[model samples]
Target: MKILVLSNMYPSPAHKTFGIFVKNQVEALKEAGHEVEVIGITNPLTGKKNVISKYLRWITETKMKLIFSGRKYDVIHAHYVFPTGLLALLFKKITGKPFVVTAHGGDIDRMAKKNPKIRQWTEKILQEASHVVAVGEALYQEINEDYQISKDKLSIINMGVNRDVFKAYPKKKIRRELQIPDGVEPVVFVGNIIREKGLSELVEAFKTVKEKRPQVELYLIGASRNQAYREELNQLMGTGVHFIEPLPQKELAKWMSAAEVFVLPSHIEGFGLVAVEAMSCHTPVIGTEVGGLRYLLRDGSGVLVPAQQSARLAEAIITVLENDDLKQQLIEKGEQKASENDEKKMIAKLERIYQQIS
Candidate 1:
């Protein structure tokens, strides 16, 4: 199969971590013996304010590349729904090509909700796609209901964990490199440092957890680009709270394996990919009950508390840490759950989707 990947989220020298899952999927496709090419709207990982200019760049780049390239692709795969996928739709109109759209949250959940015009436009794009891929069940259901997309046209396929990169590492060696004391129990949180990510609640919960277990340390690992929110989080960090800049995937896996527990206190998650990555390291995850976390952490695989409830999040974290039997149970089950969403399985499913559409 020959595939052309269209997205605004793909990684570049400027933004190494931007739309990394989409990059991973493209890599998996290539590894599976499919020829793939990508034409994306190149921009900074952050500080991208001119949406109109970005769309114009994407349109011009895609048009120039498609017209000049001699290769004819069997399918065009899009990462986001509204703009990038809409670009695919435009290409199809021009060249009569088939295209697939993968909704990675935000486009449907955030952008669609921005106004009625975008909502209608996005729905039209989804309706015209050859097929639609939803990263989570919640988003899948939302698209099905909001846009009235048929079941035959839609499928829920999460961006899977890369087991090779995310599997367990030597915790002691990682701790040594990170300078984390051996006796301390570190709880890790990896994501954007934003208010919507529940960093405030995590900080509050850590404060409560500290009162009970003084040995507990909070390790926040992510890009602290939101300076105002970073200041707020700094105010909440009294002691035993360490903040580190975003590490690459290899380094992040080491930290994930080194920590006693991983927490995802997001107010809303499209797929909770970080939780799956943590589970791939055999680390117990404690996530809030909202969005995709509800399904991902379901069935006792990990701990879940009400969203934005600091005390409840604190209680869940304390229970997982203090209870040896439960901690082990979560670890064992987490490994199993992570395996289900491994790259191999996800890639195979995507291959099947491509075959179906082709």
Candidate 2:
């Protein structure tokens, strides 16, 4: 099958960590024996648009790309609704192809709520689509509650972790390399530093956790998408809180293996990719109960706390830290569950989608 993979979410040369999910999906589709051509876009300014250019570029580049591509695609798979869905919708009208829409979280939750115009565009795309895919149940419900998309049109495809790459490593060696003390228990949070990521709340919780367990260390990984957010977090850095920018995907796996506890306090997440990656490395995760975490994390894997509740987050951290046997049990169980969501199986399901839509 010849597939045209459309995404306004993908990593760029400059910004490597931005929506690597689309990139991962594209590669998976190709590995499944589907001939895929990507029509992916990155923010030219990396999300600092002056408003006028943001709207104009969507029509100009996104719509224009489909019109002039010359080669037709059997399946048009659009990732995230904002610009990708809009462009895919326009192409569907022009070429009469089977369009598939994938809803990422912000589009269904925030953008759909704030912009009626974009919401209408997204609904038209979802309603008319041959199929829809969402990474999480929250996003699936968000789209279904507001739109008239049929039940048959939707499916869930988890973005899987590469287990071999994230498997267990020498934790003591890693800790020594990073100069972290043997006595300190490192609680690692891996994701972009943004408003919705809940890093500020993580810091607050860490402060309280420090009051009780002085040896408790907080490690903040990943790049800060917002300068102000980075600055706000800087005050807490190096005072039992260590800040590190985004590392290569390979290095991140090593870091995950080193940490005693993994925490993702994201207010919104389509799928907690990093959390699962940690689980694959036999690291116990503690994430917000909201979004895809509820579906991905069972009771055996880790603890789930309410969103934006730093106190509960802290309590959960402490609970895991105090219980050595529980931590080991969660790690053993999480590793077993994490192995179930493999790229090969996910790609196989995607192949079926391609064949059906084609």
RMSD of each: 1.7, 2.2
Q: What clash pairs does model 1 have?
A: none
Candidate with top lDDT is 1
lDDT of 1 by residue, 43-109 (tens): 6434546666777777888888678762388888988898787778877887777889999888887
Count of clashing pairs, candidate 2: 0
lDDT scores of the candidates, listed in order: 0.87, 0.80
- Alpha-carbon lDDT of model 1: 0.87
Poorest lDDT segment (10 consecutive residues) of candidate 1: 42-51
